[model samples]
Target chain A: MKKINFSAGPAILPASVLTQAAAAVENLDGSGLSILEISHRSDAFDAVLVEAEQLVRELLNVGDEYGVLFLSGGASTQFFFTAMNLLNPEETAGYLDTGSWSAKAIKEAKNFGKVNIIASSKESNYDHIPRGYTVPDGLKYVHLTSNNTIFGTQFKEWPETDAPLVADMSSDIFSRRIPLEKFGIIYAGAQKNLGPAGATLVIVRKDLLGKVNRTLPSMLDYRVHIDGGSTYNTPPVYPIYVMMLTLRWIKAQGGLEGMEKHNERKAKLLYEEIDRNPKFRGTVADDFSRSQMNVTFVCTDEADTAAFQAAAEAAGCDGITGHRSVGGFRASIYNSMPYEGVETLVRVMREFE
Target chain B: MKKINFSAGPAILPASVLTQAAAAVENLDGSGLSILEISHRSDAFDAVLVEAEQLVRELLNVGDEYGVLFLSGGASTQFFFTAMNLLNPEETAGYLDTGSWSAKAIKEAKNFGKVNIIASSKESNYDHIPRGYTVPDGLKYVHLTSNNTIFGTQFKEWPETDAPLVADMSSDIFSRRIPLEKFGIIYAGAQKNLGPAGATLVIVRKDLLGKVNRTLPSMLDYRVHIDGGSTYNTPPVYPIYVMMLTLRWIKAQGGLEGMEKHNERKAKLLYEEIDRNPKFRGTVADDFSRSQMNVTFVCTDEADTAAFQAAAEAAGCDGITGHRSVGGFRASIYNSMPYEGVETLVRVMREFE
Candidate 1:
């Protein structure tokens, strides 16, 4: 069966990317070497790193002031690395606890430096983004999660801050056009929309680094990667190569602006169906705060949840089960999720209704 | 043409492993979804993680005292994580400066706590493992690199010490049987003998954890990984899946003992050619210290280097070029390297002579 995967992360990739990646595993770009067997220092891999970085720059519309690094260890590690590199132990940083990911980042940041929760949507079960948050002066950076994969909420507007901004854009990184110059740092784990699970893309303003007041571990330091072109130590080559193929696909799809149009169409189609169907209720209270990346909802009668789940499964939908922490259905429509998949999901919802 | 790959790390993997991995990328075991699209929390991935860990335990003959974690970020990040989790800032750890990898680990360890160099071979350009050095008492752990990929040296016997031992077995893991009880921790980047370039296999004794006084970040802490079953966050799923497939292949090739016999035969063949050929000289002076995983040699005329490289390239031998730090040729005969490849390499050397 041709199934539509809606996994929140380590999620669906473009079908063409998967095909090319599989072939590359057998033989990479006619190099007579399997992509698995090639050295990271080889000219073949060097081209992959260069092209992937250039695509990230061109898509984000960033200039030389930004250093793009494809790292491993995921965004879970970035929570600590971001704070450790940007904030001194005695310094304070502002964080918005919008959802689970941001809350985790805030916890990690607190271990390195003092962290002030400038705004929080936790009191309302993170159903919407908090508004009117004050970015206090003297804060090293204002940390935020651009989109909550678990809660299915996204920041409609970023706070106007005196301090530099650091955003974890894991779920919605390339789904829309982003303002690169407004932020000091942006990082995303590649599994969602970029490529696979092994690489994280970190874009940082060059001047914002080297100011940390501690001796950073070589792997933990962003400066080490910026200086060495993400090969300070042996990098995760296969993942980066696959990411390059994905960027190539994204560029062909018209970059981030085109991605926004495609993703918005999918999101609107699903949301409209959710509102029209009497059997389903959207999880997020306000439509403005709903994420274009992950769409969450619940069966209105609650008793029909099982029947709806079975129906979706029978209709060839995968990973529609909601997060265990929050009980409901979540349909992740990342950049790669096709319009037809969303339409199929709507058809299933209507049939269930 | 199918080429014989000899890259030191991120080198050749089993042909069957590659085929299975490639197929999984398209459609995983009748799951109706690409392996790249599945969630780490899914049952399919859970089986992969379990099987990979079970295979490691069976091959290494380890018991419940150890925790096997499939982590991201490679072995480089482990340099600091190992130190941070084992040695408190007030205490010290012992390290043997055997080669480039161990030296890198020592530099990272210094950021966490005091490091005492118990022995070093740098005076001889890391041509052999240092001997006649005593391990001081009261150290937290004694760290070593089991195989020097760059210098082409391997430890024939481990240093005896009351302190817990830590080893970086990045290049030679699974090529032979290991004494798991003798070491408190063993870590390897999976690119070498295991599978791909993203996942790292960490087997640590449970008792050795939770001893460090520092506040370990959730990602850096071994306890978190152990408790969470290496899924505290989204793991490098594709790499881990590839590793599982490779481990399956290893079992089919008979276990570690079978691997030992196979690798020994390949290494002996190449080393014999280096010793007999008038045109070449092995890099490592001591015969007993030479590594079976990577064999480094130099052309006697030095001028013949270019011709030898070209001839090897023409003969379908890939990645035989040595590390830039030291010039000449390094034929990395990792576990996946077949005996025919080594025979071909030896034949190439003889023809040149």
Candidate 2:
């Protein structure tokens, strides 16, 4: 049976993307060389890089002011790199601490500059997005995680902030459209809604760079990568190539607008089941902040958690176990997760009830 | 005809490894989940990471003192990271400048501390490794590029020093047995002999860390990664998985000793042809310093370069063109290049002559 993979990140990719990527690993588009063996400097891979960048622009409605870079080190590296490039020691940056990833970003930013926790839901176990915080003047940028993969919460509405918004949208990027002009930077690891792991997708507004006083390392500097066309060094080639294919897949599925609707339908189906079924309850406190990507819930009877998990696994649902910090279940239905997979989970819940 | 790929790093991998990787991409070990979709936290990938580290220990004879980490950002990132963790701003490190990569490393290292160029072959176009340079006293570490990919030169002997030797063995790692005891750090990007691009193999001495006073970011700190077991963040999953498979293949072919013999055979076959054939001349000035992995050579008649390149391509020899800095040919016969591939190249050289 085809396993319904609900892995939070490094989660399910489109079946067709996997099939095409598999073939390319052996022989990329009949080029007689495995994608694994091709040089990043080769004309063939240059085309792949170019097309992938183009697809991001088309899908995200990006402009000339922003540079699209497929980098390495995942979002974890970006946690420091963004601050290293954007924030100075004397400068202060405001961050909205929604969940685990947000807290991490804040921690790293403190290494480079002053980080103010504008608002935080951590006191409440991050079950809801904190609201009604004042956006302080003279802040370099306002940072936030668009979605909390662990807490199963998301920023349904953008915080009204005049500071150029820098987001670590590791889990929710490309799933929906956003006001691109409102942000100075948007970075994500390529495990969710993108391709596989390794490649980090960074879209940075060019003007915001070169303003920081610190001398940045070449790999961490956005300008060096932008100038090198993301070939600054041998990029994560295989991941970028897979990302190009995934982006091509995204374009074919009608871009982000299409992805938003597709994701919404799946989220609605699963969330309704969690609410309606007495056997299960949603983890997040607020309905508005509930994530469309990762649907988290727990059994009404805590002891029944293990039995329900075994039942889900038997029905081909895998990686549904929640994070250790937040114990329950989290069904991560990213862009490629078919609606039928969610339907199967809903049916399993109904049967269990 | 199957093309004989000889592109430098992001070079060839074993054909069987590629085949296995392709299959796993579709469904990993019959788990009904594509390897691309599997979580980094899953037991499936944990096993992959554990086995890969074990294989490194077995192959390199790594002791408990050394901590093997599969990191991201490639060798380019490590150029600064090593210096950041090892050298205080007051400290000085010695570096051997051999080629482009070495020079780049030197440039990055200077940002962290005082870097002394212990020896350099740059004046002579780096055609030979510098010899007889005194290892200055009180140096934090003596860094060197084990193999100069662009200039086709390699260190025939290690410099006599008590300072822990740090090597960027990007191209020649795993091609032969090394003096692992002398080195404090050994890092290689996983494009050449390992598997693919994205994941970087970092082997660091545990005792050498935490001595530096600099407050290290979580991503750059070697100790943090060691504690996380290379799972500090989501590593380049697919590349690490492919590397594990490649390492497994290496063991099957009889470890590092077996690889050294295989590489020597390939190198001897082509180097002999270059020396005897009037049409070709080896690039390295010192015969002993010539790299076994990248056998770079030039045509005696410069005008014949274009015609020879075209003819080789027609005969299914791809990626033979040399680095743009040094125009000629570079047959990068990394571990995976079959012995038959070299024989075919020899036949091509004879035909061209």
Candidate 3:
């Protein structure tokens, strides 16, 4: 049976991409060498790095002022790296504590400089995006988790701020179109909508670097990677190659606009079933703030939760269980989750009801 | 024609491992989902992580006193991380300047603490490992690059020092056994003898941590990864899986002892040919210091270099070209490069002569 994977991360990639990647693993483009054995400095891998960067730019409409870097150590590393490069000891950066990821980012940023919490929805268990928070001037940058995978809340609108906006878009990077000009830095782990778990996609405004007074580690510094073209050392070659394949798949899907429509349709189908089915109810406090990527919901009667889970598993639905902290269900309909997969889940919910 | 790959770091892996890894990329052990799509927290992946750690402990004879961690950002990140976690700003560490990599490691260590160059071969262009340096008491640790990939030299004997030995064993780990008791920490990027380019294998003594006074970034701090079981933040999933597969292959081939004998035989075959063929001459000054993993040599006549390269290419021998700095040839016959592959390279060298 073909399992419907709703894994929050290290999530579903396009089937075609997986097939091609598998083939490349054995013999890359009939070059008689496995992709795993290729050197990062070789012309073949240089092409991969260049094409991946170009695809990111074309798909995201990234400007020339920004440098697209495919780096190792996921978004978790970027949490502190962003601050380390841009935030000085005397400067302060504003962060919105919307969910667990944002909170962790705040914790790391505080190590480098002063981190001011602009607003927080933590009191409500991060059930919605915090609103009406005044953005203070003189901040180094305003940071936020654009999409929270844990609580299933996403920022529907940009927070009004003059400081360069830094966002961790790990779960929903390619799912929708964004205002590229508004972001000074946008970093995402490749597992969610991109490709796999090893590579991190970082888009940074080149002008935003070199202001910090502290000495930066070569690997941690964005300038070093940008200058080296993301090959300062041996990069995650396999992951970057897989990402390139995923990017090609995205381009075939008519770029981000097509992905937005596809993802929105899937989210609408699943959310409607959650609302209509008597056994279920959505978890987020506000419908407007609910994530279009990870749709979290729960059974109205706690007893039905276990029954529904068993049925879903039997029906070949995998990874629908919510995080341990949330304890319900999270159907992560990322860019590659076909509409039919969501339809299958809705059918299961309807049957349970 | 199947090429004999000798690329250094991001080098060749066992053929069977490549086939199995390729199969897993599409569907991991009939799980009905691609390995690239599985969650790291899933039981399937948990088994992989556990087994990989066990293999390391068994093969390396790692005791419970140390932590076996799989991290991201490669060994380049560890150049600074080791110093940040072990060396304080006021303390000093000894570093043996052997090759380009060791030079870089020394440069990064200088950022965190006082560095003493105990011995250096930089004046000799790193053609040999410096020796006879007396170790001073009270130094934090003595750092060395076990195998100098760029210059084709290796340390045959460890220095006498009370301080813990921190080795950057990026090029030759898993190819041979070592006295694990002498080293406080051993880190290697999984691009050479291990697996691919993303995951970094770090074995650190538990007591060595928490000695540094500086507040560490969670990502750079080894303790964070150790405590998190190396899943601190979505580890390079595919890379770790590939490494696990490679580890399994290593075990099947008689563990470290079997690997050492196999590697030694391959090195001997190629080195014997290089010494016999009047067209070639070994680059390392000391015969005992010549690396068994990477056999570097040059054409006796400079003009014959391009001719040998063309002949090697025509015969389907890949990655034999040496580093541009050295400007000769580097036949990196890592553990995975079968005896037959080295035989083919030897044939090419003989034909060139």
Candidate 4:
């Protein structure tokens, strides 16, 4: 069977991207060498880095003031490095606790500086994005997560803050148009919409750096990577190459505007079935806060869970099982997720009902 | 013509391993999903992680007292994380300054505790490993680099110390048998002999941890990785998978003992040519300190450098040009570097003469 993939992150990639990446793993750009064996400083990889960075700027309409870094360590490490580079020991950083990832970022930030919880949806079980949180003055930066993969909520609107905005857009980056001027730093782990698992993409406005009062470790310093052009250490060459191919795929699919339309259509189709079908119910309370990337819901009858899963499996739906923390179903419809896959799941839901 | 790769770390991989890795990128073990798309928590990846860790234990003869972690951010990150987890603020850690990587390690260690330089070869321009330095008592741990990639020197013998020994074996790991009991921690970035870039192999004795006074960041803490089985977050999935394949290949080639014999042969052949050829001379002064991984030399006439490079290129030799810091030639013959490739370079050198 041709499985319709719905993995949350390290999720589905475009078929063509996979084909090209597989070929590159054997021989990159006709060099008679695998991309796996090429030096990070090689001209071929340098060209890959250039094109990847260029695509980030062009797709997001970013200005020259921003620097795009392809760094190792997933967003989990960024939970620390972001604060280590941006927040001084004395200054306060505001973090909105939306879900698990935001909470992790808050914990790591506290080790560096004073972290204030501007707002948290934890009391409500994070089914919706917290709103009306006042952004206090004299803060180093305000951190927010654009999409919560686990809780199935997203920030539909950016919080108004005078402090420079720093967002972990791990799940929804490149899926929709991002306003580049409003943030100090926008970072994402590359597995979701970017490419694969090893590389994290950090897009920071150059002016926001060099302001932190601590003497940073050389590898932890954003300025070092920006200066070295993301080749500070041997980079994750294969992941970065795959990322470049992904961005190229995104551009061919009509950039973020076209991606937004595709994602919304999939989300709408799946969500409508959840609302209409008696056997299924949407997990998130607020419609506006529901994520377009991850659609979370549950079987109406707990006893029918097994049967529903079997039906979905028989229909070639893969990774529809919900996160372990949340006992239900989640169909992650990222940029590369075809409309047909969502339709297939909707049919499963209807037939199961 | 098929080119021979001689690039330093991020060097060549075995052809059979490359074939399997390429196929895995398309569909890992017939999962009908690209390895790039599978979740790190999936059964297939869990099996991969288990097998990879098992292979490391089997090949290195690591006891149960040690923990194997596949980490990210490369060895550059470990240069700091090792100190953060093992060194206390008041105590001193002894560092052996071997070359660029060792110097970088020392600089990062100073941030956490007092760093003492017990031995240094920087005075000799790192042409040979420094000996006769006392391993003073009451030190937190003694640190050294096993192989100097840039300077072409290596530790022919380890310095005796009562304190736990930590070695950065980034360039020489798995190419030879290691005495697991002599060291508290052994770390290597997986680009040279291990696999590709993106993953770092860290093997640490469990007892050596939990003694540091500082409250380390969770991700930086070695204990966290050990407890979580190196899946603290989504690991570099593809890199780890490839490392497993590389280790499997190593086992097929008769493990570390066989690898050591092969590496010794390649190094002996190239070094002999550098010594005998009228047109070429070795860079390192001490014969005993020369590395088996990287063989560096220079043309006798400085004017012949460009022509020698062109000739090597014409003969299907790639990345023979030396690092820019030291203007000469470096032929990095890693584990997967075939004996035939080394012979080809020797033939090129003789013809050029």
Candidate 5:
């Protein structure tokens, strides 16, 4: 059966991207060499890297003042690298821990320097994003996850703070419009919205560097990657190439503006099916919930949630399984997810009812 | 038109593994979901994780006393994390700087504690692995890279050190029989020798845990990964799955002993071609050179090299383009490189002569 997929990340890539990626895997650029076969430093792969970074800058409205990087290790590596780069020895960095990922990032930051939990919603089991976190003036940088992919919440409006802002936009990047100038840095793992799990995408304002007190390793040195174009060392080549293909797909789908509308509509349709149907209910509080991405909801009977999932699968919708940490169903509507896929999911929900 | 791949990393994977990976990408486990669609926490992926970990132990001849971890970041992250976990803030550790990767590891170590380069080949520009370096007494551990991918060198044997030893076997893990008992730890990024770049294999002796001065991030802490089963967070799932398939392929090729024979023959065939044919000469010393993988050689006539590369490509020997830093040809004859491929290369070499 043709499946409508809702995987959170490494989720759904556009057919064109997949076709291009598959062909590139065998023979990239008609060079008789697989994309995996080319050297990272070769002009062949250099074009891939330059164009990939250029796409990130163009799609996100980032300026040349920002250094866009693609490096190995996922955003999980960034959780610590960002901390090491930004946090001075004596100063404490502030973190707003909204869910599992932000919590991971905050945990990594504590190892480098003094870490202050500005605010967190884990007390409420991450049902909502923290509202009243105070970003201290003397803090090194305030780290926040723009969207909680697991907990089904988002910071609809970002906190306006004097401290340099570092956002882990792993799950929410390219899903909407944002003022790129406000943040000192933004990092994401490409698996969610961009491509695969091997490479991490980092965009840092060039000015925020050089203040780090700790001796950074070449791997941890954002400056090294910025200078070497994220290929200072051999990077995960195939992953970055897929990311380029993904970006191409996103652009062909009408770029960032088109993606926002697509994701918003997919998420809304799925959530509407859940909320309006008697058999199911939405998980998060309505006003604070997210739309340009994941939709989490549950069936009336927890046991029957499995039945709902089975029905959805039988009806050709896939990957609607919710996180075990937060039960029920989660439909992750990333950039490549067609509205028709969401409609199929909605129809699955009605059939289950 | 067949292609013979020798790309340094993201290198050649077994044909069976690629076929399986392609099918898995389309439909994982008959669940009608792509392997990319499933959560790392799902029972299906968890099975893959367990199998990958188990295969590491089986292949390495590591007993139950050791902890095997599959992490997302490359060996670069583990370089510091290893130092962070093993070194106390007040103490000094020993490092043997052979080539590029070891230098990076040494830099990451300085962030945690004092580091002494017990020996270095920097004066030689890393053309060889350093010799005559004895382990310093009272040092936390001795660190070395078993093989240098870029420089095309490998350590033939390790030091009989009183201090515990740690090796970044990133480019040469599983290439031959390792003295598993000699080192407290051995880590490799799974690209050249293992599988792909995203997943890192860290095998650590259990007694060396919990010695660092600072608090640990769950991801950075070796103990955390051990305790949480390396599923500490959403891992690089697809990469891990690919590694699992590669391991299976390795076993099917008669495990490490078979792999050793296969690699030895391939390297011998290529090295024989480079040595006898006046056209080509090896970069590393014959006695201490890598026998199992990464054979880099130069042609006597510079003008003949590009023409030779084109001729080799037409003859189905590809990815033979040498690294830019070390110009000429580098054939990374890792385990997946079929004997037939090497035979074809040898035939081409004979024609060159």
Candidate 6:
């Protein structure tokens, strides 16, 4: 059976990226040296570092105003470091707690600063994005997750807040082209869109740093990672190199604008199928709540959902299984999930109906 | 040419581990699902977590007295966290400054508590480890990195100190059987001797918790990663999975005791060549030096060393280039590096002589 992956986060990467990464692991740049074998300080690997950051700037169209850092520890690390670097311990930071990831970030940020819950939909079980919350004055920054992967909901539009905006775009980054200037900092854990786990791509507006009153650890300090050129220590070399390859793949596919359109089409194919089939009902709230990446839906009869999953697996569409917290089905349609794969998923949904 | 990888980690991982990891990435557990796609919360992946922790404990002979955590951030993060967790704001921690990693670690620890340089070989250019130091009675702990990869020096034997000993054996962990009872904590970044970079292996004694006065970020809390089974949040899944395979390879090659003999033999072979060859001279001080990994040496005629490194690479022995700071050649004979590779290096060294 042909494998069509739908697993969230370490979701499908561009097949070309995989091919290049696998080849690099064996022999990088015809040096007969495995990408894993080269030092992060080496000129060859340094080029990988420089190109990755440059491409990130190019993709976002951000100029010298922002500093792109490739650092260790995933987005979870960023949840704390962002607060530690941007907000003083006594200062209050506004947070929009949309789902699990945002909650985790809010919880972590609380350790570093006083966090004000600007708005939360936990009262409604996060089915819809909360509205009607004021972006408090004197707030250090307004923090929010761009997309909630587990809940399968996203903020269709970002709020126009005067406060500097910070986002943990771990699950939905690079899937669409957003206005990069709207946020002070945007970081993504690379398991989903960029490459593998272990590496985090932190793009911070240069001037937003050095405001926090805390003495940060060197490793956790964004300035330290920035100054060290992300070679602060032997970086997660293979993963970062693979990320660079994936970024190259993104560029080859016509950069951010093309990827956004491509992702939208794939999301539409699956969402349209879910809505058309009476046997299946969309899990997320209509119009106000929908995730372009993770399309969650339930069978009208939940009993048949397992059968549908098994059938989908038998048909070679993997990771169609839904999250246990919100049961039914979730098809994670990352940037790398080919349109053909979504077409296959649509076929399965229609066949099930 | 057959590549003999001696890169100082993300160094040479076992070929078997690589093959299995590649296969897992392609197809996980014959479920037709890629390992990257599946939820870490799944029963299948949960088994990986349980078995990996169990395997490390069993391999290290860690009893109920110690808690083992596989954390997302590398040992670099722990450089501060460990101090913060153990040392009160008024208390001080003692450190032995061996080389770059230790110096970096000490710098971070200074943010949390008073840092006392109990001893340092930095004035001597980190070519050797300090001989003896009395641990301050009021100090919370005495921290030291057992093996200094950048400088090619090891403690050879640990200090006889009353204070708790914390070892960052990042480069040479699992290369020898540690007297586990002597240290309160042993942390190793998994890039060397274990698997890829990103995850840190922390072996901390059960008694050392809830001591620090200040609140720590959840990510920095060792207790969180340990109690949460290293899945407090989404872990560096691939890095930890690959590390498990590397651990399995270590066990198959006769565990740590077996690995010790294997490592000693490999180190002896290369060191013997450098000692005997008139053209090449060993860089580290003979009495206090490393054996299991990271052997640095220089040529009698320093001008010819560059040619020798080129020749070594041409001979398919890569990563023999010395650290820029050390200014000489280094053969990091990590556990995964085959004895045959070292022998090949020895042959090249003798030919140069």
lDDT per residue for candidate 1 within B91-206, as digits (tens), equals: 99999999999999999999888999999999889999877888999999999999999999999889989888899999999999887788999999999999989999999999
Q: What CAPRI grade goes to candidate 5?
A: acceptable
Q: What is the CA-based DockQ of model 6?
A: 0.53
Q: What is the lDDT of residue B54 in candidate 4?
A: 94
Model 3, residue A328: C-alpha shift (Å): 0.7
Judged by DockQ, which candidate is best?
Answer: 3
lDDT of 4 by residue, A244-322 (tens): 9999999999999999999989899999999999988988989989999999998888898989999999998999898
TM-score, candidate 3, first chain: 0.99
- Between candidates 2 and 5, the one scoring higher on TM-score is 2
Which residue pairs of candidate 5 clash? B190-B196
Report interface Cα RMSD per prediction: 0.8, 0.7, 0.6, 1.0, 2.6, 2.2
| Model number 3 iRMSD | 0.6
For candidate 1, give the DockQ. 0.84
TM agreement with the true structure for every prediction: 0.99, 0.99, 0.99, 0.98, 0.91, 0.95
Query: How well is each residue in B190-274 modelled by candidate 3, as lDDT tens digits?
Result: 9999998899999999999988888888888889999999988899988999999999999999999999999889988988888
In the range B284-347, model 2's lDDT, one tens digit per residue, is 9978899999989999999989988888888888899899888899989999999998998899
lDDT of 4 at B178: 73
* CA deviation > 4 Å runs, candidate 4: none
Clashing pairs in 3: none
All DockQ scores: 0.84, 0.88, 0.90, 0.79, 0.41, 0.53
- How far off is residue A226 in model 1, in Å? 0.5
lDDT of 1 by residue, A131-224 (tens): 7667778888999999999999998788888787899999999889876767999999999989888899999988988987789998988989
Which stretches of candidate 6 lie above 4 Å from their native place? B288-290
Q: RMSD in angstroms, all models?
A: 1.0, 0.8, 0.8, 1.2, 2.9, 2.2
